[model samples]
Target: MNTNVTPLTTVSRGGDAVLFAIEMRGKKLTCSITREALEAHFWLERQANEARLLRAFSDGRKRIVAIAERKARRLATEVIKLTSQDFER
Candidate 1:
């Protein structure tokens, strides 16, 4: 798949939304996220900051969570395709 999506963001009082646009094979596709589900991503990305406060922690040897995030990324990727599955009223 020749796919590349650069996320652009807009922040507001309620929350944020990311826009992804793609052009491929003479076709244009756009994805608008009304209410971004950011909890999982924010939490996962906070490991570096949290490390300073905690003295000891586990490295999460098992990669169970990757399975879920992988699926999540796939869903988000599909949005760039402008697939009906990601459309919202």
Candidate 2:
């Protein structure tokens, strides 16, 4: 499978930055931004999926959908570590 990786965004809190990965196909991508970047990535994925569904056939779109889902899940898990609530748990 052809894979392309690119840095999407990054979230910074305190002196540390949390990087979020944007994986496409088998490729993995990451970057650093502010906490708002996480939310933006989620929103961007939603919009892109909507556009993709309208333009691509169902059978050809699963890979992109899966990639987005996987990235979102991974990002959420990592973000938890940067939160104060993580220590409380």
Candidate 3:
């Protein structure tokens, strides 16, 4: 779609995942990646705090959003959730 993803300000804990958002073409899409995914894919610690998790997310933001966009395109959904399996080749 030739759109860029801009991360939203608010990030929250959603059970075992971190809930966040990304704006694409003026629309905000809810996105999340599991704690397990973060640990396995983003170099996050298993017992990380929220700050650490946020840092890991920020560091890997580009790759994360790219995958999310692909998932959104394939699934045609407004919500994108990433699990550890999403990272497996």
Candidate 4:
């Protein structure tokens, strides 16, 4: 993980939504959001995102959940990529 990336939040679940943040190599890329409205899309996105994250981290470990922000709800169907290294220390 980069020393410049800062994670605004980790994993947050409430009501029917999940929220979190993505930091890579020490830089905040963007916030993410997952909710019922975009559950299907979010799931798919999460798969790809996790895959990339895994490769980037490549620690042979797995991420338990996806991170997102409430505002990202609108971009659920779009593609989003993140890595553990992005978070700042």
Candidate 5:
């Protein structure tokens, strides 16, 4: 239960509330991600954004993968920080 361990979330059932699991230090923290106090939110926007990025870089091959991997890392860090706050509640 070390506060220092970063929480990594995997979101599911995205439609008003998301069922999510956060793992850290070989342990998992389960929680919900709500939209406007509701239990699910549509993930279409996120999917569309990722699709757009992929289409735009369709020809970039290794370059695109590298860039995307970096972006993924940054996004993962951001999400970990965001979800970590849920533990306070």
Candidate 6:
């Protein structure tokens, strides 16, 4: 399975997470990282608005996407949701 994670990222609809796209086997999949994960791992502030959350995600995009890709490979799912626990290792 070939996978490529794009740099394009956006805040989730509810503004509680950041969503990004992953292209795998000619299909696009959506993945997300919770605001809690951003706060704990990506230095996001409490009650941050969409802008701040997006900035945090952009700043940590590389690491975040790497983890998301790993999860996607291991779990083999169409959607990946990364929480704070995903970064524990």
Task: Give the number of the best model, judged by TM-score.
Answer: 6
Per-residue CA lDDT of candidate 4, range 15-81, in tens?
A: 2323333444343445333332233332333434433332322221123123332112435522343
lDDT of 3 by residue, 1-89 (tens): 55565555334645367777776656778888888888999999877778888888888887888888888888888888988887788
Tell me which residue pairs clash in candidate 2. 10-32, 10-33, 11-33, 11-34
Compose the digit string of candidate 5's lDDT tens values, residues 30-81: 4343332221112223334434322322332233223323333555442322
User: Could you give candidate 6's per-residue lDDT for residues 3-48 as a string of tens digits?
Assistant: 7878788887778888899887786778999999999998999999
The lowest-lDDT stretch of 10 consecutive residues in candidate 2 is 80-89
- Model 1 TM-score, all chains together: 0.32
Off by over 4 Å in 2: 1-53, 57-59, 77-89
Residues 1-89, candidate 2, lDDT per residue (tens digit)?
34343433333344233444545445454433322322233222332333332232233224433444454467753222322221121
| Alpha carbon lDDT of each predicted model | 0.31, 0.35, 0.78, 0.33, 0.32, 0.87
lDDT of 5 at 87: 20
lDDT pick, better of 2 and 4: 2
| TM-score: model 3 vs. ground truth | 0.83
lDDT of 1 by residue, 1-89 (tens): 34333343223333333344443334445543323223232222332332321111122211212322333457554333221233222
Better of 5 and 6 by TM-score: 6
Q: Count the backbone clashes (under 3 Å) in each candidate.
A: 0, 4, 0, 19, 7, 0
Q: How much does each candidate deviate from the true structure in C-alpha RMSD? A: 10.8, 14.4, 2.1, 11.8, 12.3, 1.9
Q: How many pairs of residues collide in model 1? A: 0
